[model samples]
Target: MPSLDDQPAASDLHHAVLAWYDMHARDLPWRRPEASAWSVMVSEFMLQQTPVARVLPVHEAWLERWPTPADLAAEPTGEAVRAWGRLGYPRRALRLHAAAVAITEQHDGVVPDSYDDLIALPGVGDYTAAAIASFAYGRRHVVLDTNVRRVFARAVAGVEFPATAVTRAERDLATGLLPDEEATAATWAVAVMELGALVCTASSPRCGACPIADVCRWRLAGHPAYDGPPRKAQAWAGTDRQCRGRLMAVLRESEGPVHASALAAAWDDAVQRERCLVGLIDDALVVRVGPESYALP
Candidate 1:
């Protein structure tokens, strides 16, 4: 593990990253110069544990409907949940809606410019907060996501892979690598993340096209294979998560509230279906409209 104090100068790396990004960065909607802070924040939340390709259309449609925090805040939570579509984790939509409400009520209906204030919002974790603060507000923050972490681990620490999650050491190192100019550092953060996503992938990395391949410590260290345990694949069909999504989708598409029978018909397993509904209700993703009817909160 390389300490922050021992890391290489970030200027050269920053330039290299920016150069690569200028040529190869994808034209993501959130990264557009005209995109609002709320749009960037929404993209960050939706991109969590989900791919950019899958998030693109959903993000566009969402922005088209609710361009501002106030717009989303004015709508019912059910709309947000229903608009979430098959994004796997429906809870993110609920959290995002809550965050929008917080922004509307607390932050003058504008996404906060400070990292602390952004992170303080409901469901805004370190990654989302840093991303929004840096990408949207041009604040000097070390945007450390999974992709960024992997890039740093391989390039700086010479590790085959990153730890299970981000750590303090990782944050410190990332901070060290940030450029002197805040805007440039923010752009570099996104560029590095994009590089990891496009070229230095988890599976078969296209090292031939990598900009920092020459400086990659992992590659210079004989390109050793990752020795960790094989990643376990989670099943989607018949799972509680799937059942919960199905139930929420029905409620989201409904105008008022959905009947218990309508929700029950979504899943075949009665026990799993009921548990999913209860879990969603407990999580505040769904609310009881009547004695036996449920709708998204």
Candidate 2:
């Protein structure tokens, strides 16, 4: 097994993966030089647990309507939720709206460049803060998303998957592998993430196409299967999430508030429908305007 302490091997891995990225990186609008910091921030929010193809059109429409943080902030929160358009997690829209309001009010309508400032925004966590700073501002920071984590698990630790939650050890490994120069480190972070997304995918990793296949510990170790605690499976049908989506879809399509009967027609289970409606209200994704009438908020 190659040691993590081996600087020469680490450098080789970096160079090989980065060279591969240079050749194959997707020309995402958010990654382009012309993309604003707001554009990158929006992409990050929309991309969470959502596929790129699904997010692309919505992202384009969103930017077209509200080109800046101030523009989004000027609109009603309900407008934000309506614009979200079946992204699954509606709360992300609320949080994104809140973050936009913050950026407009606190940062003069500009996405903050500093990690601390970015992290201070609503819904911005460690990984997000680091990613926005590095990817948007070209700042050097350790940006470990799921793909990056899985790549590290297989290539460096010889594990099929990482722990369900990130550990201190994983953070340290990412930090250690970050390039010294700011620009190089920034590019390296996204490069590794791209490699993971394109080649080292979760279910069907293309190890044969990987740049560091020669040094991949998991491949060298015979591609052992993951034996960690069972990963959470996402259930859709009959779930509250689906119920919520159906109800939200009704509200989104309607120009005015929908009656309780309209919402009841969307989902058959009266109890689950009512429960999810209340939950959405509590989550501030929905608002009640009249007796038994609901609308996006």
Candidate 3:
């Protein structure tokens, strides 16, 4: 439970971070100066739990189709879900569509400038909302995603990691690390997050290339090992999440509708397949076209 005082001063860390970012930042689409707020928002949503390589093409195609929240809201949910091909989390498609609709109706197709307003939209949780607000709107906020949290926990707290979920104390600590000026703070948050993604990765971190390595408390303490139990890996091949993804893929490929039997073909286990299909329909990721046909919604 180390505190900020026990680590390098905030100013030192900020300077190191900004300097490192300027020299080594990746050439990402969303990070471009010319990228629009809507494009940034779309990138943020797509990048969640997905890799940068997978998100690049999808983000480009998505923006090409619906440049604004109003443009997406104008289309059917099926089209949105269809465009979300193989992104792993299909529900995010529905939620992103819902958020677009909300933005179109409430904010006149514009991504909101305020953090509170952005958070009110569907699927825009603390991380997404803070990202949108800071990166897109240039507003000051503590953007604590898994990467940022881990970086800070190790660098400042000398702990191997933060909690599985962010806590209020983490939020407060993140906010404190922010610069006094709004613009600087926004840049710092992005830089730190990028640093974590590239250098301080979850496994086999590149400490040699880390910008703040010289002053990081964790490094000073000899990079002590994480003593916690190993995290359990979620099953993918024969799980409900896999079944849901397969069913959505079928609907995505089909223009009009797909037979329920067709979806059952995705899995061999009849009980599990049936259960997954029903869950998708119940979750509004898919809709029953008729008694036996289903389509993405």
Prediction 3 TM-score vs. true = 0.95
Candidate 2 Cα lDDT to native? 0.91
Candidate 1's displacement at residue 262, Å, is: 2.8
Q: Which segments of candidate 1 are over 4 A away from where they belong?
A: 1-9, 235-237, 253-256
What digit string (tens of lDDT, one per residue) describes model 2 on residues 190-234?
999999999999988998899988888888878999999998788
Winning model by lDDT: 2
lDDT of 1 by residue, 1-297 (tens): 433334444776787889999999998889888999999999988998999889999999999999999999999877888899878688788889999999999999989999899989988988898899999988888888888999998888877798886778888888888888877888888899999999988888888998887778887777888877765698987777778778877876778878899987888888888888888889988898799988777
Q: Against the hidden true structure, what lDDT does model 3 obtain?
A: 0.86
Selected candidate, larger lDDT, 1 vs 2: 2
Worst 10 residues of 1 by lDDT: 1-10
lDDT of 2 at 58: 93
What lDDT does model 1 reach?
0.86
Inter-residue clash pairs, candidate 2: none
Residue 178 lDDT (model 3)? 93
Give the Cα-based TM-score of candidate 2 against the true structure.
0.96
